[model samples]
Target: MTYDISLDKKKAILLVVGCILLVVLSFFAGLFLGAMIQQPETVTAAPNSEKPKKASAGAPAVLAKKLPAKPKVRLPVKPKVKLPAKPRVKLPVIAKKPAPTTPVATKVTSAAAPAPALPAAPKAKPEPYPYSIRLASFNQFKFVLTGLSQYRQKGMSPYFAKVNLGEKGVWWRLFTGYYPSRKAAQAAVTEHNLKGVQVIKTAYANLAGIFSSKNELNDIFKRLDSQGYSPYIIKDAENHLRLFTGAFITKKGVQDQNQDLKADGIDSKVVER
Candidate 1:
């Protein structure tokens, strides 16, 4: 052991050792780079191996077992049923009663008998006084009025009549008392001592006017005469000259004549005799 090495040989050995170390390190680095690149491929290939696959008809039993099994689903169903039919029903009928009838009575009729006749009554007798005494006649109604007043003073009710004597003209004849006979009438005139009075048979005569004016009297008298009326003059109690027209047998006849006079615009009233 006591060998002594030279400096140039030591340096030559150290160079050889560093060259070896460099070559080894380079080889290890190349190995590590190859491992890293191959590790990513292996990781990608591992996931592909874990993925599911459909089983084929011709596949092996080992592959069918490796596939996942599917779950089974079931649905519910309804059942059919049958029911019985309903029964039929019938009702009873009712009867009605009849109403009662009433009996009617018949009436009998006969002809009525005629009534008996009654007896006729007797006629009444006429009045007996039919005569009148004609007192003094006057041409003027005023004179007749004065005469009537004198006779009334002597307690005699003297009434006058108008007479148309044709050519002799109109005269106012004063009269008093009704007598049954001319003899009785004469006897009454004598008893009264009536001057210039005569017994005469007289009937009912109408006295139609009692006018104050002689002109009016003449005018009415002429009018009545022209109209087929026999008008004459008489005197009333008030000394008014009145006109007389007709001599009728009945007072009814006088009334009819008065109606005619009224129709001719001469108003007349009934004076009963």
Candidate 2:
């Protein structure tokens, strides 16, 4: 019986040995898987540094206990975002200029340069006889004759011309040889004590205009002096002649002059030439 029990025990021992090898291989594979997991965890923990660590069976448990739990944390609520108000800006003011004052004022000056002078005036021609007058009407022949005599005494000559006006005989009487003006003739007539004395004006062709030349006037007076009359002629400032008295033509006129003559007075006569 002992000899037959030894072969059966050897077959039982091979079965136990195969089971033990399988158990050891499974333990080493479990250890390798743990080490692989530990290597990734170590690499993740030291992202900035390069190092290695050995894996252990109890490492997962210890690491899990040391890790912090996710706390009930409320993310900082975004504070009420309020934009600040914009600052107020002020604009600058520009002052305006005043307008010009006067009507004549401008950019140009008043005393820039003087203008050219104007030309002078021409001289005027002088009058031959500066003064003259006219008489409107006259009456009384005797007064006219007597006025002629008085004019001759006052350094004047008488001219008498007659006109027939119906029943009245109109006498045009004139006096010449005024040194200044016929205003002297009118003044002489006003001062006289006689009646019906009227001043008559002489024309340019009468006294002043007719006797313009000096030699011609001198020749006329020489001829009158040769005919027994003291005739003299003189010129005034305006080159006008003053003819003086001469002898009487009629005898009755001479006697009247002699009768009317004063002590210092001379005879008035009309001498024919």
Candidate 3:
């Protein structure tokens, strides 16, 4: 055995070469083992980083966005609460006037209030046309005044009228009145047919028909005119128409005319005017 492990130059050189090759192989193996172990460490680092990225993306569910807030400030509402309108002022009303018919109603009330004082006011009036008998008209004022005074002494109410003509003359006519009417005055004239009473009352007349209608008197007037009798007309105090003879003033002349009118188929009478 000692003889077989003998050192030679060639074997010694081969053995040293093999030892170098082993050392090189060992160094490469160690380097390969370290690289495989470090690959697991890199895979572990990638899985750890992916877990953080997934966690960061899912964390956005808790968003910090703010919602719309209610308006708490109310400045415009305070101005609207203070605003109020003023009320309108009132005016006065006018009064109305009374009607015009109120005075007429008052007059009717006064008329009904008193009835006895109405009739006493009318009895104090004097007579309008008192009766008068005209005696004679004188040419002088003094003579008629003297006649009026003399007639007044005979229980006659006497007055005189002055007849005036400008620059011509002034006369006075005497009369007696204060009687009732003209009919009574004519009765006095006929009763007192003395010297200076009526100028026609003492005269005679041939009387014709006394007519109440003018048409009846017209027929007689024509008949009397054809018989040559000049007729005259007079009105009595009662306004009655009296037809007579103006030409026959004496009794003998009226008697002759009455005979002539009777013979001519006309009936008549003798009268004193």
- Score each candidate by Cα lDDT: 0.67, 0.48, 0.60
lDDT of 3 by residue, 127-242 (tens): 23323456677887668667867776777655444444458675554555423555666677676553566422224556686655566578887888676554545555544556
Ranking by lDDT: 1, 3, 2
Angstrom error of the Cα, residue 163, model 3: value is: 35
In TM-score terms, candidate 2 sits at: 0.24
lDDT: worst 10-residue window of model 3: 116-125
Weakest ten-residue segment in model 2 by summed lDDT: 201-210
Clashes per candidate, residues 3 or more apart or on different chains: 1, 0, 1
Q: What is the lDDT of candidate 3?
A: 0.60
For lDDT, the strongest prediction is 1
Cα-based lDDT at residue 244, candidate 2: 42
Task: Give the worst 10-residue stretch by lDDT in candidate 1.
Answer: 117-126
Write model 1 residue lDDT over 185-241, tens digit each, in one string.
888978888777778766665666557667757877787767656565554445556
TM-score of each model, in listed order: 0.34, 0.24, 0.27
Off by over 4 Å in 3: 1-202, 247-249
